[model samples]
Target: MSVNIPDKGRIFAKKSSFYPSSCVTEILLALLGIFVFIQLFYYLFVFSKLMRHDPPTAAYAGAPEGVSVLVCAWNELENLRELLPLLNAQEYPLFEIVVLDDRSQDGTEDFLKEHADQWRHVRFIRIDKEFPHITAKKYALTVGMKHARYPLALMTDADCRPIGTDWIASMVGQLGPDKEIVLGFSPYYKEKGLLNWFIRCETFYTAIQYLSLARAGWPYMGVGRNLMYRTRLFFEHKGFYQHKHILGGDDDLFMNQAATRTNTSINLDPESFVYSIPKTTWSDWLRQKRRHLSVGNYYQRGNKLRLGLLSGSHTGTWFVGIATLLWGLFSHDTLLLQILGAVFALRWLVQLIVLGGINSRLDRTVNWLSFIGMDIAFFIYYVGMSGLILSRKKKVLWR
Candidate 1:
């Protein structure tokens, strides 16, 4: 009826005089640090294998059978002029280019009209009404989608430039008989300094996660810069119906509702890539990220859980690494410090390797150390802004 408790003397005896309460705390912190490093290592291993066995590029001749391309523009007339010519030069046959002018006060409508005669496939939709939601892109896309004459619809932004003449062909070619959606890679054009390098690095990292998950049969999202889906699938799934009340999540949320393992894919072929201009300013980038993070609330529970773990891993590593370093400095625990350094080095090595692979994959040049600093900044900003946005009901406006 009564359970025996361990003798206090025995318990006390097991505790080493050298292992003070502070030492115990330090030891626990060190173990936590090790755990984070190990988990990250595991992710790297899995991610590496996914990269190794990525699906080969699909080869479909001519234009995508029954497909239409949509580009949405606000005040990007000059960019659109460059982008339109590139679109016109695509090798794809039997496709049309439709641009939705989101009530641009700039000469965007005039530019489209001038070019409409020059390019037969070119068409324009002028959205005169005020954008209904913070997700202005989605509203414009919806209007464009209605005008599409084909069953398959592809969406890209005005700032994106196709990598090759076969860009459209490669993307459309990936649509298997049963597949309803295909996510394509959107890399960035090179830039001059650390910010640009960091942007590319961050973009590459995002690509790795999305591409790996797509390979793993859990395709959750795609960038609007180079994304394709069946026109019917959009309407069938109610077309961002539930998440429309929110300001973000046109891509991921729609993909969340519409994509299944059998119906989704990633087109990683070099020819299928599209390059977009990176945000030039840190404030601009932060706003973009804030809009993106606002939609995290709408992800499927499984995805939410995965993302939570990923965030925790980064947060855990930073806290544990700093705490352990302080412990080593204050307590002079050389062994503990060595363990922490070893873990940090290993994590950095894995990240560097993974990042190198990403860089090579995207043809980017990154200052690895500078990228680490940027990553930390991003982590802090994302956590803080995301927490604020998710808790508040204010609609996110694109700056």
Candidate 2:
């Protein structure tokens, strides 16, 4: 007597019931499929809507508000030399430039002192020392915030250069009675090398996510490179008093606590954007990424969970999808093979549409030939960041 043999899929399905790990993998894939599909919807619909929104240069009509551009320099005399002149040239009628020379052993203080007389609107404060226990940036920024004469504080880095003369006006133009925080896009300058290209794409992708989330009415974080907030809000929230111990998060943590759907606005106008110099070496880039990732643990619980789900799903989609495809190939499971291939193709096509438009709007360059490799690289980046954030032995010192 012989038993009847089922088809390949039916045979695999029958065995999957008996194999506990296989059954668990199937269940996990099913749930992850649902999650990743939802995430794709967010990317396609919600973030695409943001891409379609008018650029702030054209849409925003608010009168020029009093704005202060805050830049903190730490051993960045060369950068400040190039950066200060650009700030002095901004066409905005009412604004001031305040620089916090955060204990720089370099000639930042002397450079500022030499040029301080020429730019009447520019002010510099020398911070040679701070409370040894506290992070220097928080202390330095607090001092600069106090020195700002304008009600609106626009913050950027010494290494960042404004693209256009209207950068200040474009940023502060979004401020009204209701909107107190302005999230501006900052992109890394495009360079010939692969590292710079990846950095540019990463920066643009990050900006798109944060700006889209803000547009979705779930504002979470902002990049300090081109972020603006009300001066009063800083004082109301006690000015980073809670997270002063952390080296980073001055911009993002403040936004996480203070920014609201009604109060926050995003501006991706080309003129509003700034160019940040990307790290040239692999080690430096990783160090910069580590510092940024370090503050993520301090984010609001809801935002943290939401962002975690997004990243987790991205990693799972690649990892488990590849594994399933491999298994299906060997097991002769044609349906599973087709399903995984179709999902990846569909998601990539949608991403091209959504991210393509965003890249165009933000003036970022992406190498389509290496998109998959970059995606995998980003997964590695996220993993490394996780290890760095979790390790107590490893510390991210403030720059």
Q: Number of the top candidate by lDDT?
A: 2
Give model 2's clash tally: 0
Please write out the lDDT profile of model 2 over residues 1-399, one tens digit for every residue: 999886999888878766965674586469658767876977886789777887444333445567889998889999988998999999877889999998898887888888888987788889978795568888888998888898899999999999989998888767667889999988888788878877977887788789998988999999889999989999999999888887888889889999998999999778898988888998788777777886787889989887888888787777677778777776676777777778888887887778777777877556555556666777777777778767763565566
TM-score of each: 0.87, 0.90
Compute the lDDT for candidate 1. Answer: 0.77
Instruction: Please give the TM-score that candidate 1 achieves against the real structure.
Output: 0.87
* Candidate 1, residue 37: how far the Cα is off, in Å: 5.2
- Compared with the true structure, what per-residue lDDT tens digits does model 1 show for residues 239-317? 8677776776778888888888889877867888899989899877767777787677789998787667666677667
Which residue ranges in model 2 land beyond 4 Å of their true spot? 1-29, 55-64, 367-370
For all candidates in order, the CA lDDT equals 0.77, 0.82
Kindly provide the TM-score of model 2 when superposed on the true structure, using C-alpha atoms: 0.90
Worst ten in a row by lDDT for model 2 = 55-64
